[model samples]
Target: MASERDYFHLSGPLHLTHVKWDNLYHRKSVAASLVQGVYVQEKDRQEQRKGPNALAFPWWAFFHFQLLHTLVDDVDNSIFGAIYEFKPPPSKCNDTLHKTPRYVIAFRGTIKKPDSISRDIELDLQFIRNGLHQTSRSNIAIEAVRNMVASVGGSNLWLAGHSLGSCMTLLAGKDMAKNGILIESFLFNPPYASAPIERIRSKKLKHRLRIASSVVKAGLAIAMKDKKSSSFDSLSAWIPCLFVNPSDYICSEYVGYFEHRRKMEEIGAGSIEKVATQNSVISLMMSAFGKESEPLHLIPSATLAVNFTPSRNFKEAHGIHQWWKPDLCLQSKLYKY
Candidate 1:
C-alpha cells in the first residue's frame, strides 16, 4: 500500500497560516492535516526506530497549532492520535473565530506498516464486531478524551479522525454526547460495517433491498423492545461533520443510509425506519446470541458532505488528503433529527 506521503507530497512548506478557522474548507483542511501528522509521526517511529522526531511535528505548525500530547497504543507503541493546542500568531489571535477550538484531538487511520499493522487490524476487526469499545486502546482514547473535556470543556475542543480512527472518535464523541457534552467533530471516510449497498447500480433494486433490510431490522428491534434504550435519541442535538466519497465503499454507505431514511419517510414508513435506523442487522444478531453491541455507524445527526469529484482508485477515493485539496467538488447537507 502507498503511504500518505506517496499519495500527497507534503515535503514542501504548507501555506495555510492565513486561512480562516471559521471557514468550512479550512476547518476540514486543519483537521485532516492534524490526522496526517499522526500518520507521519508513526512512520517516523518505524523508520527512525528511536521515536518521532521534530520532522514528524511539522504538520501542526503549518496550521498554527502546537502538539500537546500523543496517544500511543501500548502494545505496538504506535502513534494513533494526538492532541493539539491552537496557537495563532499575535496578529491573527484577535481575528480567530470564537467557534475555533482551543484544543483539537485528531486520530489517524490504519497504517499497513509492520510496526502498527497488527494492532491496527485487530482494532478494525473489533470495530466490525462492534467490540471496539472493549479494547484497551479504545479505553485509553476514552480516558484521554474525558480528561481533555473535563479540563477544557467540550465546546473548546474538537475531535477529528479518519477510517478506523474515525471509529474511535465516533465512539468517544458519542460517549461524550450521551453525557450531555457536545464537541465539534470531523469524521473522514469513516467505515460503515455493512454491505456496500450504495455501490449497487440498480437504484430500484437497491431501494428494494434497503426496504427489505429495514423491515427485518425493525422487526428484530421490536422483538427486543424490552432491551431498547432511548439514550441514543439524546445524540440528536450533537451533529458531527461526516466527509464521504461515493466511490469509497468503506464510507459510502452513509450516503444511502441518510437517503434511505428520507425515502422511508416519503412512503410513510418513517416509524419503521426509525427503529431500523437505530438498530443494525448485525447488532440485532449479536444481541440474539447474548452479546451486547452497539453499531458504531449509527448516528442521530450529521452534516454529511459527499465528494463528487472522481477518484482514480479506491485509495484515492478513501484518502484523507482529498479533504484538504482546494478544488474539491462537494455536495453538503445537514441531516438533523
Candidate 2:
C-alpha cells in the first residue's frame, strides 16, 4: 500500500520468471515455463467503439478462454492487453452501468500444468493432461488479487474465469470472502455452473469487448471525474453464462460453476451463465463421459469435477478470426460474437 508497485502479490518472489517441471507422464524429460502462466491467456481482442452518449461501457475486451487482470487509478483511457494471438468478443459488457466492478477472466476446462500457473507445457497430450508438476503455484490467488485491490484503493472486488481457471478462481473467492475479503466474482464459460448437481457448463451467452484505449482521452472525460461514483466502492462482475444444458459440461472443465456459479449468480447474471457453454466443446464430451448409476448417480465430485461443453456445441473457437481469440497486441476488430 506504500506505492503502486508495492501493491503487488510478490515483488521479489517473482523469481519464478521461468518454471521447471518434467514430462514424468511420458519420457524422462524436463520443461521450463513462465510461473503462474501469467503470459498465457485464452481468447479476446480490442475494438474502438466511442459512444456519443457514452464511450466506455465495456472499458476493455478479451477472447473466450484468455486470462486478464488489471488495476488502474483511471478506469477511463484504459490500457487493454492479452497474452495470446486470438481476441475474444467484447459483448459481455454494459454501456452505462450503475456501478464499476473489478474485472477478472480465466479459461475454462483447459487443464494447465499442476502449478495451475504454468502455461507453456509442450509434452505429449496425455503427458500434459496428467496435470504435470507445477512449481511456484499460489494456493491463494486472491492474495495476489487482494494485493491488487489494495493498490487500487478498493474494498470490493470482482472475480471471473473460464473452465478450470474459473473453478479455481471461485474457490479462491470463497477463501477470500471467508477470510473477510470484500469481493464479487464472475464465471465466463466456466465448466461447472451448478450448486447441488454438476452441469456441463455455464449457460450465460454474450460477448464483451475492450474499447478503452482509443477513446479514453475523450470518453472518460465525464465518468472519471465523478467523485461520488468510484471503482473501489462498486466492485462486481458481469461475465460468464450458464450452460443452457448443464448435462453436457465435463467435470474438470466445469469446476468454477460448481464452486461459485450460484454465488456469482447472486451477484451477477446473463453472461455468467451461457457464454461459457458457448466457448468450449469439451463440456459435451464430459457430459457423456460419466454414467448414471445408483448412489453416485452423477459424476464424481472429487478430482476434476464439473461439467464441460459438448463437441457438437461449444468447440474450441480460439482465433483472432473466431469470436474467442485472445489478442495482446491490441489491433484487431474484424470478428463478431
List the global CA lDDT of all models. Answer: 0.87, 0.27
Worst 10 residues of 1 by lDDT: 4-13
- How would you encode candidate 1's per-residue C-alpha lDDT over 1-337 as one tens digit per residue? 3344632235322556577777898888889988888887788778773333335666787667899999999888999999999987767764646758899999999998999999999999999998898899888889999999999999999999999989989999999999999999999999999999999999999999999999999998898772554777888889999999999999999999999998899999998888888888888989989897889899969999999999999999999888987788999999886
Expressed as tens digits, the lDDT of each residue in 1-337 for candidate 2 is: 0222111232212222221212110000000011112212111112222243222212222112223443111212112111111133455333422233333322233432233213322211212232111212223344556565665533334444433444444444544543445454433333332222333233332111111111232233233332212321121221122221233333222333233333334556423332221211222223334421111011111222112223334342211011121221212111111
Clashing residue pairs in all predictions, respectively, total 0, 99
For model 1 the local lDDT of residue 194 reads 95
Name model 2 segments beyond 4 Å from true.
1-95, 102-135, 153-156, 189-247, 251-337
TM-score of each: 0.95, 0.32
Give the distance in Å from residue 7's predicted Cα in candidate 2 to where it truly belongs: 33
